[model samples]
Target chain A: MGIVATSFRDELLAAGLLVPLGADGLYGRAAAFEDVVDALARLIVSLGAADGAARIRFPPIEPRSVFDRTDYLRSFPDLTGAVVTFRGDDAGHARLLAAADTGDDWTELLEPADAMLCPAVCHPLYPTLTGTLPAGGATYDLQGWCFRHEPSVDPARMQAFRQHEIVYVGDAAGARAHRDRWVERGTELLADLGLDVEAVVANDPFFGRVGRMLATNQRDQELKIELVVTVASADQPTAVVSSNCHEDHFGAAFGINTAEGDVAHSACVGFGLERVTLALLRRHGLDVERWPSTVRDRLWP
Target chain B: MTDDVIRAVLAEHGRLAVDVAALDPDADLYQVGLTSHASVNVMLALEDSFDFEFPEQMLRKRTFESIAAIRAVVDGLTRAEVD
Candidate 1:
């Protein structure tokens, strides 16, 4: 159904980068796509440093208490996926197993919510704010394993993926500068990969009533932009990466007082490593050696 | 303990910074410019430089935030093995 589907998978694997994650025989649009995933990600952090963004890596998971503050759930409710464990009596476990065997989901039998579920596209800057700041504004590049509860049949859009975020948590001007630079630079870099991509001003998909207000506000502020390409189909271009300027949302929520005791705002450029790799593979044939000389030299070498 | 080792290792990675030693033992890794991806890069560099395997448990937060923290973990992991 897609470029990474069984039909075109081997074509991509011939590039020598696509490694199989499952036996679907779906030729996953990219070779060692996971390595490409990592390579592009490393490129992301390196870009952050080049743009003068401080680099930081958070735990793959975030504290639920903090995730609630950002209201990430309110916006990405559909993209929301979680990891939860079931604890119950042995009889209950046996019942659940039997139910599962019978093709009946026994999830309703146990507590739905208990420990921390994965944060949907959320990075933890709160823990990083130990009440200090540089004389100037600060920019940070954050990366972690992010999960989405919803699964897509498209290999490019996996249920679980990695995100490299370069955030500017400081003054509004600094935040804008940081986000703007990456939005432009990232598009150019993608172009270098020999892909035709565009940067579109976008917004977060907020959940309910409060979400409506936030989503609209996000759109108005032009705070988020996605690097989109026609992968699934030319008519329906999909977003591969995002660059966002989150103003003071993180600063106010995290009590991240600056050196002068002012809460510093924040912005970030997020790279969907898998999607980018998928885009690159779809752009060029899967053969690693045949990729653009520049991209090829950088990656394979 | 010297720049040559770190620099030589970093030279292998065209993009990643090689000044990992600049990081303090407890300084927040992000604060010292160590993004998670870069953390992996540095780890890879260490692996290549020392030519050994690091214990998986050491990959946790207790030892990754600072170079001193990483060195201690790597040094411990490397030293405890048969050379």
Candidate 2:
């Protein structure tokens, strides 16, 4: 919305990293963007290798039943997107065709599918870990395309995005330590990539009245820490990475437990791939060849 | 009074369920239903009402936890502007 943001959007469009669709928020990423994203994913894995996390890849769509258990609707009802399909018979098909001909709301013929687009990478993993943990607990590396219904003109904010996460499931102390360590590690990682970034205490964008209390409680408890970079605007930095301590929220909800039969505490560190790419382009211009040698070596080498 | 002004801003921009007047000076604005989205609106309104922008250091949760805290920060920033 600011002058800097407009120019940055134009830069992204011209660089082939982002292909702007006719719609406001939807944009197609070129190979250059995907190249950066893949390189960053490798960097994340290399950085996390010492932790020995079990690698898992999830589909973009999650089971609706599993998603319902997370109660995301209660907190972020506005951002959830459901997958729908046309499950109609002959009469329904005829009506749908009529609506399409009339240029009316043809989507009314579509019914809800068994799955919904995953809002976060960790949602499906929780259901998979629904039993006792091994010894001191477990750690996982997950990557997936995540969807949120938030549409914005800022290139930093996308309706659909990719997230790479390192998740820890264990005791409270272990989870907290994991979050703290990653908060520091993530800051150093971004700095290594030659971008100006800051780590700040933040809250989720919860919805409505009850959500206010939840957000305040989250901040008061120091549950979320975000690494923000100035991509769209200098005044309002966008969060490129977030380290969240869910405590026992997910563990209890999904019945995940420690070897001692106690509810496990959970923590996750997620890197927003597209956002980080945008930040790099914003900082070093669109041409990767012109970027600082140190940054090029770190990412490309 | 600052409390009156604070209450007016909350009433106009916040989605509170309780009466603004009945709230204690130290009452937690978030606990009484001031969402993060609405907090931004409240912050902008407060800046307009008092004619001073909040510094980055004053943008934390503690700064707007209560009417008293908001008043303290506003008074401090406005006083600094005068000096």
Candidate 3:
């Protein structure tokens, strides 16, 4: 007897919904798979169209200098990925080739590139929004590929994924309201798409001992909240959406001030595009055509 | 005393907007603009100055909320080291 696909990841691969590319947490999506993702992206844009957010699409990587200025490295050094390239002379290239020929680690020859793989879709936007805001501050509608170094076998936990985010920069009260409203809206949106969704307090995967305190502080302060759905199993659910209040962190770092002269406060609601698509697949089955009429209409219309 | 050492460490690394010496011991470090990023540096410096590593349980924000709080933790760790 052959092996039965028990895990959602295995089922996804077996159904040709996901194509393995010889790496954990990395895969190529089938056209149908990509179609679902596209539909979800469009749905998010349509939902937020009334807000008049300035739409911006960013490259997958951001400047290392800008990235270093942020606290991402201090908090999540383990999960941050930076781009490295060969910036050496011919002699160094020859040595690299020799090392590669012998199956030795040749990556030591590569130097740090000017960029780091963007960990969040909103990360690159802060630097551009420096200086004081005009009137009610700014809001942005953004979508971009984000990279994290967490390689996992869970299909929903892709290392490279697309994020659709609506970010607002304004006063502290406005920031909290933005995050709170999204927590409600995101949960409702996912539930409308035919997924059993729940909102819960969450924390980032901070690094080291000091990070524990940071994580605790973040949770205590209710800085982050995630919209979770059971994609794989009831025991292990995935966060498909996250609403975060940065609360002057980015304002202080980027020197963005409010119109009233105090430091600006910021918040963002992010949708994990791939994870939401995966949850739909897991809940409704691999075939999008056979999904419930209500779900199909919500996604397609 | 640990109080003076804590004061000096805060002056050098707390990155607070206020003068460390003039600030009250019970005043909130965060209220004075000691960011989480700066707090990590202060934690490291405290570890170095006292020659004792803080246990994981003592790594909460409360452990470093104020000069008095930091002094209490430092004294506890040093006393444990001595015992």
Candidate 4:
């Protein structure tokens, strides 16, 4: 399937999602669009931070072992492009160059002996809450620059994106409630922002043989919902936010048990901060005050 | 699981959603929408909901075929645990 990209990059640039990183695509400064990003992040976290959920922060890069244990590696291994330490002397580089000169792929040189990828969301963080002891469950207000090697360049589905999630672990009822409540609450919040959005059954982009079964189970369970908005196109709305309830998988793996006794089930309300900003820009003009009166009223100081 | 259950279980991948059980047992899992990534997800879900760890040797392909096949594996593991 091919995407009708249709100036999506230009639209986001016009909307202040990008700044000229340079001719090389390695780096570009983020626009002051962050002013809005910070606000959006705050709003999402605040909504998720309710009910006995104590907040925690974690380093951006979670370990490979951690991911492997969670089956995150099994599910979306393709998305995992990682950082590696090359203690190679100059001779090693020369050998790699020679191999490349023979018109072979670059896989030979880029092997990472020890490595990690920035997580897609708070998936890595959920499992870590295991060992911590708490009177109640722990809730985290988390934000990170997550990286995924997605083939879609829809501007909404960026290769590198910002995600903020409110993660909760402990109490199965609380976990399901967190996921169930947010499905309604999140849609209302987005509606208040003045964007017409769709909530649909969605699932993780698991790869390979197991992906089919996973997708079926996902649709069967209706475990995920995509909050979508039509930014540049009416037919193809972008998913700006999501809510997921990951029963007790992470709690069991992390050994995060409840104070009341039992395996802790967990849930997360994850927002693609950048995706929401783009949706906002698509609905209203880039100028803050020029947006719909309702939105402006909600956003104003 | 019965044919209806199998078809429903395999259908969410979009291809097999119609009548996976009608197909022959040897039909490739990928042909029926059991993508490699989704396969891992299904495995994780099985482990989670059933509270059973997957066997290491059975982690290879050719295992996740028809609904009956999955049930056989799940049952064998289940029966073993119960015993």
Which candidate should be chosen as best, given DockQ against the real structure? Answer: 3
Q: What is the TM-score ranking, best to worst?
A: 3, 2, 4, 1
Query: Best-fitting candidate, measured by TM-score?
Result: 3
True contacts kept of 2: 0.09
Task: Give the Cα-based TM-score of candidate 2 against the true structure.
Answer: 0.79
Question: Residue by residue across A1-301, what tens digits does model 2's lDDT show?
Answer: 5677777888888777789887766899998788889999999888777688889999999999999888888789999999999998999999999999999999988999989999999899999889999988888899999999888778888898999999999987889999999999999999999988899999999886546656776887789999998899888999999999987778877999998887889999999999998899888888877889999888989
Candidate 1 RMSD to the real structure = 21.3
Candidate 4 docks at the CAPRI level of incorrect
lDDT of 3 by residue, A109-172 (tens): 8989889999999888999989989888888999999999988877777899999999999898
- Which TM-score does chain B of candidate 4 obtain? 0.68
| Chain B structural similarity (TM-score) per candidate | 0.62, 0.94, 0.96, 0.68
Give per-residue CA lDDT, model 1, range A162-269, as digits (tens). Answer: 787777666767778888888888888788777799889886655554354455546655778899985655655768888887766677667776667766767778
Give the per-residue lDDT of model 2 (tens digit) for B33-77. 675545767877898999888876565667778999999998898
- Give the Å error, residue A178, model 1: 0.5
Evaluated on CA atoms against the true complex, candidate 4 attains a DockQ of 0.09
| Model 4 chain A poorest 10 in a row by lDDT | A20-29
The parts of candidate 4 lying over 4 Å away from their true place are: A1-4, A14-16, A20-32, A93-107, A132-136, B1-83
* Model 1 misplacement above 4 A: A1-31, A51-54, A112-114, A117-122, A208-212, B1-83
Interface RMSD of each: 16.0, 8.6, 1.8, 8.3
